[model samples]
Target: MFRRHKPSSSEHKRDPAIHAPALPHNDMRSFFSLSQLVLSAGHLKPPPVLRHSKTTYFEVEILDAHSKKQICVVDKIPPSSTLLDVKHKFHKVCPQWSPSRIGLRLERNGSYLRDSVNIKALAASSIITLYFTDMGQQVTWTTVFLTEYTGPLLIYLLFYLRLSSIYDAKESARSLRHPVVHLACFCHCLHYARHLLETLFVHKISEGHTPLKNMIKGCTFYWGFTSWLAYYINHPQYTPPSFGNKQVTISALVFLLCEAGNHFINVALVHQNQSGNKGSFPSPSINPFTWLFLFVSCPNYTYEIGSWMSFTVMTQTLPVGVFALLMAIQMAQWARKKHQLYLKKCTTYRWRKRAMIPFIL
Candidate 1:
């Protein structure tokens, strides 16, 4: 029923085999085309990849203190730590080593580094070589002071109680004890008891440990002197002072006053430490005994010497006098050293002040 028509040139040129083929859904070309289209439209982005870099750490080289031979090299140590922390790390490598036993030195002849020193605060270097020294037997300062004080207190008491065989048979049968002897025993005991108490409760003692040899030497000095004084003072032939009861009363008063003064001074110093008032010179506050600070640099030593002097006067014995004189000499030396330290540490310290005495050395 349709009229016949001639075929157009485009339709005559078109062939089914020559036409471009449509891409399949799973084809690589189809995927690439889809990715390009999404990228051009700014709808998708590539994911980020993480790459790890080599970790960096500080190096610590340890060497024998005496021989200077390499002992061990510790690597990968964190810089934000302390010498004490480093010691623990070293302890892990050498199970036998301990923090207390290890002493680290920056130089061959220099002093050992304190445990509180920070690792990062040290001089900057690629490798830090620390001299390792084994600290021998050590004891705390508190233990040394307690032992030294307690020994003298008990040893002197033994003499006063007549428990030792040093006294004669006739003297042992005496009816009543001498009043001066009784007073002397009380003063001696009180002096050492206060010292023990201060060392334990009041004083802010540093955490430094002392060598056993030094402690032995100190104990020898204290124990030997105590025995000598106790023996002579409690002797049967001991005589009262030539000035009689008046001299005894006056000396006893002086001893008690000085003992009280020393205790007050110690308390004030402890307060000073707690308040963190280090730079300024220490001045007396309500306690008049602390007024000695105005004239003398080491008023505590001055009070100590005065107490011993009063004891010497009360007993009036050659051994007691000798002990007081020797103690004075030693305390004088300590006072001078402390005075120098105060001057160095506190520039505001008065230069007119004497070391131990009020106006004389």
Candidate 2:
């Protein structure tokens, strides 16, 4: 059974912000501080190319209620146009918006109103709201899945990176070598890059573009993505120091168990939210370890630190090992804050409910 990090009752009494719905639990939060701002997966992709695959090229359709003229228009669209283009279109419709403040409305099929919306295929009830009067008078776009529906954009960006690296293959090979060492490095870069883009885009599109103090504001790692990553590091191919098959196999299984538990919990959590039971987005990636954290506090961070430590032992990568150490320091800060919050808020909360570990700390 996974434990959910339960703060004392006294902690809940004092902090209203602590009652937030599930926050996205992306691992990128641990990598770059810049990722907290870019929240979506696709913000970093390049312009779309519309390759002639089975998927059709993007098209826009306009419908109007007799008296209500369609206020939306697309003056000019580059095939490589980006979210910035959609915002620019809004500025033309209503001149008050700055480039920073302007955002376009999605047409419910999860796309910009005028670009590539498969409206006919969408639900009759899906109404894309471009502006929220409750939040503000100025029109702004939704940030749920900008990159999900879009294509060619991701294609362009990925190809660019791969080719860019290819152009420098000779030089890179001299230093990084080939096969597993290189693949591991590649995965590491992708993981960090993915985190940076996802976090930054989320900030820009959904959360008002405000900077986060740091990524792990108050979440636990219930998800064990880090543990799996660690498995490779602990392998002889990566980290010969911890190259026992038992640790590799055991850590791998523990990670899978966390993954399975996460999905099972998600079935209920996702269904509950679908029935209009939540305030914001269901977390980005909730793992099984989350349930574990209720009792353990910060299991995600603890597992991650352990993963990297083992990885360091396996791969003998001093730089990445140091990176993991710094991450632990950050997690320690989060745990300390939670510990104080527990004492202050939860009258019934036991003093022994340590943030990262139980009883020992």
Candidate 3:
């Protein structure tokens, strides 16, 4: 056989599509080089095409919270609609329902949805469902409080005036009126009167209604306590405190100071709330009376407890002391709750801040 002609080295080098010449037989280096070339070309394969599902509008269904009956289906609600906007749209179909009296929830028994939440903010599917509950017979918190406080103020004065036949006439004639007793009556009236004024004007209480049952319970507590305390304080046989005039003077002064401080704190707190600076730690300003906030998270409760303690000292009666003690316990509970709320909302709150008392509690 004729000898095969070999291609020149220049021809192999010049051709772009020329395959490499055959590797030397059983040469491991040449075999490895061929493997590397194959691996380098693998990236040329096209990546799998990615598919996405787009959502434009949402479908919403409303159901009664209690019976789980389907109220209506809302088709094609835009993402920009707020919860309040949805409520208004629901009101159009259901004429019996008012927006203020309607509470909507995400689940059957879940907490009501806030009006501020937007439909787009929720991680909802194409179909969104909301449960509705009827919020019946609403009254403002200020109205409820004013009603409760007003009753006690007038009822206590009835006892103070001795207008009711509750006291014995013969004993009343023999009983000597202590100056401290008159002072206590004046202070009690002043306190409740101030509360009424604050409820009407100074406080920027939120525009929310309290339940009828809660209003009843609050009235019972306040009116009942006023009767109980006023009965003893205004009694004909009531005697001067054991420590006499000196104790009365000092306690009365303390009571006045604490009452003034409490009013100031309430004003400051109302101003703070109105300023829309919630979720921030409260600090003392130019008002020195509010400086108690430096040590206690709830200085209002501190001053409240102080006022009651002073009253207990001035009266020096078992009932007054017991009332003061009970009030302290209740106020401490309120203070602890407020303190916890402050801690949760305010990142910069002082770790050493007490609930009500300074340094001790």
Candidate 4:
């Protein structure tokens, strides 16, 4: 057999398509190596990356307090939101309900949740439940106080002026008004005027509101009692105090002292609250009026009762006495409630301190 002749390297290089088929002239792979193709593809047209972001969202479910049925759901709220923010959201969903008229609680019969509470703190998990109460038509505390104090001032003034419609024409024309009557009018006006001024300028009232019906009832009581008291105190037939000037003088001095003490105590309370020490046990300060705090939990109420009692003694009238008695009863109730709150919240509060009266109450 004849030996096959091997092809030389120069022959293979010179001949085209001798061992393999020829490639297309426009082929890209012809000018690039495998590694170069991969690197260029990566830099020019990279693959897309899939990324997912995680965020925490909260859901608040509102239910009726009485029925325990779902009212609405506030969803997708951020963890940083507060109860006030939730109230706004709820208001948007229920246009008929106002933020002031809506009361929210954790349980059906629980106390209302404060607007300052954070939603994250209230949430046990991603979803939180709240109870809703439809507080009837609301009025601000400022409006209620203004109405209550203003009516007494004006009503007493009307009687004091001896208006033709209110008094007998013959009685008004014949008998001269007593000096005590004038003094009583001055005291009454001063008391209510001070209250009005304090309500407008001094008191640090909360943003809370009261029911309209309650305001109406309060106005009725204050206005009715004022008219009753003024009719007798400013009457032409009215008699002076029983022990004459001596009794009147002593009672007036006591009234003035109590009034001054009450004002100072109120100022101290406002100052303490502004100093960011609210809800803490208030101690005696440089002011002498605050010394009563050592003996009584509510010195303001004590001074208020003292003022009214002195007024009753100065007038020496059954109406004034009745008014003072009723007022004292009410103030005592309020003071007791406040005293209990202080005892519960402040560990340093003295257990021996009374509510309104010291030593005996």
Question: For model 1, where is the 10-residue window of minimal lDDT?
Answer: 15-24
Mark the 10 consecutive residues where model 4 has the least summed lDDT. Answer: 26-35
In angstroms, how far off is 16's CA in candidate 3? 47
The global C-alpha lDDT for each of the candidates, from Candidate 1 onward, is 0.86, 0.44, 0.85, 0.89
Indicate the TM-score of model 4. Answer: 0.82
Residue-level lDDT of model 1, residues 45-147, one tens digit each, is: 6788888885446788989999999988877777777888888888887767767678899998899999889887774785888999888667889889999
| Ranked candidates, highest lDDT first | 4, 1, 3, 2
lDDT of 2 by residue, 273-304 (tens): 55683432223235444455455444545555
Report the number of backbone clashes for model 2. 43
- Candidate 2 lDDT at 277 equals 35
Candidate 3 lDDT over 276-349, as tens digits, reads 99988767888889999899988988998898899889988777777788889999899899999999999998
Highest-scoring model, lDDT:
4
> Ten-residue segment with the worst summed lDDT in candidate 2?
210-219
- Cα error, residue 167 of model 2, in Å, equals 9.7
Clash pairs detected, candidate 3:
none
TM-score of each: 0.79, 0.35, 0.76, 0.82
Worst 10 residues of 3 by lDDT: 16-25
